[model samples]
Target: MIESKLISKALFSDKSVKSVNNLKDYAGIEYIASMNQTHSDLVTFVKSSAVYDSDGIYTEEPKLGLVVKTADCMPILLSDKKRIGAIHSGWRGLKSNILEKAIKKFDVNELSISIGPHAQSCCYEVKEDVKKYFNDYTELRDGMFFLNMSKVLKDLSEKEGFQVEVSSICTICNSSYNSYRENKTTARQFGVIWK
Candidate 1:
């Protein structure tokens, strides 16, 4: 199973030591070390480390859990109901098709996926250059470009034979949730998932 929570300082701190310990306690899953996320699309396959880091892709490992953290960015969860994966996918990661690549890594014919809260199109305005990266077939209007990342991932997952569930919450619009856009000068909330 996969579960996510907006971590608070009262629950844990940002420091590596505390974060790792807290994950173990809260989720009963060991801390597979966090990766140095550069927003790139490099996937890794982990087998034994309690904590593992990757830029994008991760294959099934023996670990009881995997975790990824996000603020305004998206947190993608993948699992076969046995092995689980967590990915931090922002605009850059999405363009790279990190989720698609991860799905390709598995040999199984089916899996379950979840796309967590993120900056939705309503608030995720971008520059023309960025918009140009999308195919012309995409729908666009009034100088605004909207990308349903969850739908995109769902479609991709279906193509690869995985069942997907999407959470219809926009972090920027939800004041209860932490958003980099809403609180530029404040601390960002951690989006953590583990199984």
Candidate 2:
């Protein structure tokens, strides 16, 4: 698990999906509320631990870790002093403006955002069909097109009056974390946050 400097309670999992679910052993979290994560724009306000059909989940309750699982998709953790949230942002989520929807739950000025490992521009190649959703963030290199999701995420968050600290680690480039694009792996890592 990787702890954040901005918020010590927030953690980005380097372990497998199964191991990360057992947060009690490592994070001392009593309950874990993980999202179903359909890559949609649904943002759910959570009070306790339960699976919700949402790509973004937030909580004001203490010890209830908001977990987001991802392979190559971005795992974003949002926290103020009292509330915490987690978001699963892939191409679909970004297109749907999932980050904008998630941050609206909290005071933007008080929000501290952290983006975990994901497929970066260096390896996040997309097809012509996917380019329509992100024309501003995509670039043509050689014969392939690459998407800069970090720029889209940061720009969106900053425009909302908050700053975002994005992780430099790219899941596709790092063997330590699972990458669906890199190896078609079914495994996913987790990002957790608690009040």
List ranges where model 2 is wrong by over 4 Å. none
lDDT of 1 by residue, 8-42 (tens): 11121232323444665765655454556678777
Evaluate all candidate structures by whole-model CA lDDT and list the values in order.
0.59, 0.86
Model 2 Cα displacement at 111 (Å)?
0.4
Report the C-alpha displacement of residue 139, candidate 2, in angstroms. Answer: 1.9
Q: What is the lDDT of residue 159 in candidate 2?
A: 70
Q: Write the per-residue lDDT of candidate 2 for residues 29-126, one digit (tens) a residue.
A: 88989888788999998898799999999988987888888999999999887789999999999888888888889888888999988999998999
**Total clashing residue pairs per candidate?**
7, 0
Task: List candidate 1 segments past 4 Å from native.
Answer: 1-20, 48-53, 57-63, 135-142, 185-195
